[model samples]
Target chain A: MNERYSRQTLFPAIGEEGQKKIRKKHVLIIGAGALGSGNAEVMTRAGIGKLTIVDRDYVEESNLQRQQLYTEEDVFEKMPKAAVAEKRLRAINSETDIAAVITDATPDRLEELVQTVDLIIDSTDNFETRMAINDISQKYQIPWIYGACVGSYGMSLTIIPGMTPCLHCLLKKIPIQGMTCDTGGIIAPAVQMVIAHQTAEALKILVEDWDAIRTTFTSFDLWGNQYTNIKIAKAKDDGCLSCGEARTYPFLQNENLMKTTVLCGRDTVQVRPPAKQQLDLARLSEQMQASGYQIKGNPYLISVEMKPQRIVVFNDGRALIHGTKDLSQAKAIYNRLLG
Target chain B: MNKLLFFAHLKDEAGAETLSIDVSGKTIAELKTIVSEQHGLTKIDSVMTAINEEFAEDDDIIQQGDTIAFIPPVSGG
Candidate 1:
C-alpha cells in the first residue's frame, strides 16, 4: 500500500483491507461533467484500481466554474471532457488505470461496458440517460450510485439490485420534470455535496460494506440549510418494472426516447435523429449557402449562422443549435434544414 | 403558524427561504394553493413537499410549528 492512501487506511471502516478492495474494484462513470469529475477525483485518489469515463461533449468556459478536473486551457483547446479528465486522474494516481471514451452512451454500448465493471456511477445531467443506466444496472445486478445537483440543492441514492429500490421506483412517486440547470442555475457547493455523498457510497460498495450503504433517498439544500432522507426501503415491490419480478426494461427498449435535449449551462439544444443517418457536410454547406444562410464546413461538422442563432450539425445527424434553449424552436430548425 | 421553507429554484421563485403562514390545520394541497397565489407560481403541484424533514403527500395535514419545505425536481449534473 502506498503512503498516499495512509490517511484513508487509518479510518477503521476502510482499514488496509478496505483499501485493498478499493484497489481491485473497477468503476464506470457515465458522464464527465461536474459530478462525474468530482467522483472520479475522489475515487482515483482513494486508489480505485481501474476507471472508465465516457462523455460526448467537449469542455467549455462555463464548465470551469463547477467542473473541477477541467481548466481554461482545456476549453481553449476544445478538449473532450473524458480525455482531459482521464489525463488529470492518471496524473493524480498513476497506479490507477484510467481510460476515457469520447462518445454518447447508448443502450447497446452501456450493456457491453457495464459487464466489465463492478459498479456504475450516475453523473449524467438528463433523466433519459439516468433511466438507461438504471435499466442497465438492474439488468446486470450491479450496484450504482445516483447523484444530481442544481442551484443550491442536491440529491443522491444508492441502488443495489436486489436490496433496495431502483431509480424507476422512486421516479414513479417523484417524476423528474422541468427546471434544468441551464434555466435554474447551479452553484459549486451543491455539486461538491452531491459528489461527496456519491463517492462515500461508492467506496462502501467497493469494500462490500453493505451495512453502511444508505437505502433512503437523501436530498439537501445548502443555501437553505435543510437535509432530508426519505424512507425508500419499501418503495420497490414485486410490481415495479425495473427491479421487480417481471423485469421489464422500458428505458432500454428504445421506445419514446427523446430526440432533443437542452444542454445545461449552454444556450444550446441538441437534436439527435431517432435513427442514425450519415450526413454530407460539404453538400449541406453548399445547400445552406445557396439558401442565403452563411455557412462554414469542416469534414466532421457543418455550421450555419443565421441571425441570432447558429446551428452546428455533425455527420451523425446530431445538431447542436446555439442561441436557443427551446426544444420546439431547435427541432423546427433541424427539421427544416436537415430533414 | 407553520413555517414553510423553500429550496433551490423554489426559493428563487418564492424570493425567500422561509415563509411563516397560519395554515396549521390545512392540508398540503390547500397550502400549495395558498403559496402559489401569494408567490405567483404556476406549477405548485409539481413541487414535492416535506413536513418536519419527512416526505409529505398532498393530502397530509400541516400542523403548527411544522417546517414545510417545497422542493422542485433538480436534474443537473
Candidate 2:
C-alpha cells in the first residue's frame, strides 16, 4: 500500500479495506465548474479507480476566481472544462484513470455515461441538467450526490436509489430560483462548504458505510450564519415520474432534451436587465477601461471580448452574448466582465 | 412568537435571515402570503418549508414558538 493513502486508511471508518473499495469504484461527475471541480479534485486525490467528467463550457478568466482546477493559462487557451479537469486530475493522481468528455450532458449522453459508472455527482448550474441526471440515476438505480452554491448559501443531498427521495420527488414544483452565480454572485467558501458535505457522503457511500450517510437535505448560509439538515424523507413521492412505479423518466424523453437555455439554437443570448432601462454605454465602456479592460464600441453599443465569449452591450441595457447558448453562463460572463 | 428562517434569495429579500413573527395558527401558505408582501419576495410559492426542522407542506399548520425555515433552490456550481 502506498504511504500516500496511509493517513486516510488509518481512519477507523476508512481503513485499508475501505481504501481498496474506494479505489475500485467508478464515479461520474457532471459539469466542471466550482462544485464539479472541487468534487473531482477531492475524489481524484482520494485515488478513486476511475472518473469521467463531462462539461461543455469553455474556461473563462472569471472561472479562475473559484474554479480551483483552472488557471489563467486555461482561460487563455479557451479550453473546455472537462479537458482541463482531466489534465489537472491526472497530475494530482496518476493512479486514477481520468476521462474527459467535452460535450453537453444531454439525456442520451447521460444515459450512456451512467451505464458504466457506479455513482454520479450533480454539479450542474441548471435545473434542466439536474433533472436529466436525476431521471437517469433512477432508471439505472445509480446513487448521486447533489451540490450547488451561490453567494454565501449552498445545499447538498445524497440520493441512493430505492432508499432516498429522488430529486424528482423534491422538485415537483421546481423551486425556480431566479438567481445564478452570474446574477447573485458566489463565494469560494460557499462552494467549499457544499463540497465538504458532498464529498464526505461520497466517501461513506464508496466505503459502503450505509449507516453513516446523511438522510437529510443539508443547506446553509455562511454569511447569514445559518445551517440546517431539513428532513426530506417525506418529500419522497411514490407517484414521482422519475422514481415512481410508472418510471416515465420524463427528463430522458426527447421533449425533455436538456437544452442549455430556454432560448437556445442561436449562439447569441440577449440578456435584458430586470427592469427595462437605458444603459450608458460610454460610461460603462469607460468603467471597463478604467478597470483595465480593452474595449471596442460605437455610440449605440459596446463590444468587449472576454475570452471564449464576446459580449455586445446595446444602449437599451440588453447584451448579446456570442459563442455560448447557456443562459446562466452567459449572464455570468456578462456580469463578471461588465460588473 | 414563531421563529422564521429564510434561505437563499429569501434571505436576501428578508434583509435578515431569521425573524420572530407571531403566526399562532397560520398555515405555511398563509404565512407565505404575509412574508411575501413584507419582504417583496415574488414567486416564492415553490420554496420548501421546514417546521421545527422537519419538512412541512403548504397546508401544514404552524403553531406558536415553532421554528419555520423557507428553503429555496440554489443553482450555481
- Candidate No. with top lDDT: 2
Interface RMSD of 1: 4.2
Q: Tell me, what's the RMSD of every candidate?
A: 9.4, 6.1
Estimate the lDDT of model 2: 0.83
Cα lDDT of all candidates, in order? 0.81, 0.83
lDDT of 2 by residue, B1-77 (tens): 99998887687678887899899798999999999898766656767789998888788899989999998876777
In angstroms, the error of model 2 at A71 is 1.5
**What local lDDT does model 1 show for residue A229?**
80
Worst 10 residues of 1 chain A by lDDT: A172-181
TM-scores of the candidates are: 0.77, 0.83
* True C-alpha contacts between chains kept, each model in order: 0.58, 0.77
Assign candidate 1 its CAPRI class.
acceptable
Pairs that collide in candidate 2 are: A151-A186
Whole-model alpha-carbon lDDT for candidate 1: 0.81
iRMSD, per candidate, in listed order: 4.2, 2.8
